[model samples]
Target chain A: MRYGAEILVYLKEGVLDTQGKAVAASLTRLGYDDPSVRVGKYIRVEIEASDIDSAKETFDKMCKDLLVNAIVEDYTVKVEELR
Target chain B: MRYGAEILVYLKEGVLDTQGKAVAASLTRLGYDDPSVRVGKYIRVEIEASDIDSAKETFDKMCKDLLVNAIVEDYTVKVEELR
Candidate 1:
């Protein structure tokens, strides 16, 4: 079976986000209220697996091995069977 | 009131995603199956607004004005009141 996984990787709390800060400043300068912003990566991947469990397992390994930076980032993943 | 908005920006259909292609190729080389991948941006913003509708409106303007590349990318945003 094939599955689709959506992975969101974000910086850990308390970590400085220079990009986000810059964006927020821009918005404020553009007349929006003082807004707080955080930026992250959203990755969608299609995987071939026998079942949902194995698909999720593969996603976990992918995150740990390559997708996420464990030292400063955290990730959440959701997987659904692709019809 | 305070509101939180989550925005996802992705390339339109048929747009070439070089970064995604590179990551997918690396994953395959690292023994994962030939998975198809798409990469996007996830932005979380906190805004001060009177209501959810206004918050969404602000988000729309944000996307149009600065957050998204309208020619090659599309975006979806969801807003919820912050407690």
Candidate 2:
């Protein structure tokens, strides 16, 4: 069997996204006046695991310990088993 | 008119995805054993710009000057005209 996880991490609300802001400003410069652009990063990961449970535990740990910084960023994790 | 950009950036080939590696190791501990997984991130942006060309230029400049560090990461940018 195989397990897979997809993680999305992003800045918490209230944090200024300078890049997103600049892009928005440029849009006004270009002429489009109503488009809304927020910049964010998404990570898609595939992994080999023993089974679903361990895959889940490990992934949760992975997110907390490594993938993202909890204070400034918030993340969601999903795990599925492929047999 | 509105402008949008989507960017996909990932670590260049040969750089060990440390977290990715750890996730792989944990999978073996769980029991399902044949899935291969790799991790990567995606970003979607919507910006207000003067027009298509300027939107495109600012975006290109955006990527080189700020969005990504060219050495360790590789990225592709796409722009679309929205109404």
Candidate 3:
């Protein structure tokens, strides 16, 4: 199966998103009006695997072991099979 | 043309992502291991428009006015034409 997975990761509320705020400021400087902003990450990965189970196992492990950091971010994965 | 656009918004480096961290914890509790997490947002928009310029205008406006809050995030858009 062709494993195409999209994962979205985001910071918890109240976490200071200095980067996001800075971007907002830049936007205003560039004449764009931005009232609020939330920053998050999105990743799309295509994997070569056997089935849903293996895909899940690999992705789940990847996310836990490398993709997501338990200390600063959370992630969710949506898997799609293309074959 | 069928306008398919994908935009990714991310916090500048040094920005804190609290929500992402929380999710990492949840994953760990749920039996996943996470090391470091960075949170950002990804948006995919499909618009029925005339051409690239129009699609650009619509998306640029949407990101500035609605999709991205200039105050907290930086966004870049990629457009694909589907006929």
- Enumerate the candidates' DockQ scores in order: 0.92, 0.29, 0.14
Against the unseen true structure, what C-alpha lDDT does each candidate score?
A: 0.94, 0.68, 0.67
Q: How would the docking of model 1 be graded?
A: high
> Once superposed on the true structure, which residue ranges of model 1 sit more than 4 Å away at CA?
none
Q: Write the per-residue lDDT of candidate 1 for residues A1-65, one digit (tens) a residue.
A: 99999999999999999999999999999999899999999899998899999999999999998
Better of 2 and 3 by DockQ: 2
lDDT of 1 by residue, B1-83 (tens): 99999899999989999989999999999999998999999999998998889888999999999999999999999889999
lDDT of 3 by residue, B3-55 (tens): 76667876665667676676556556665434244456765566577799987
The alpha-carbon lDDT assigned to residue B5 of candidate 1 equals 91
TM-score of each: 0.98, 0.52, 0.53
Q: Please say which candidate is ahead in TM-score: 1 or 2.
A: 1
Error of 2 at A8 (Å): 0.7
What interface Cα RMSD is found for model 1?
0.6
- Determine which window of 10 residues in candidate 3 chain A has minimal summed lDDT: A30-39
Q: Per-residue lDDT for A78 in model 2?
A: 74
For DockQ, the strongest prediction is: 1
- Write model 2 residue lDDT over B1-83, tens digit each, in one string: 56877776777888777755665566555553533445555555666677999888867776676567788888888899877
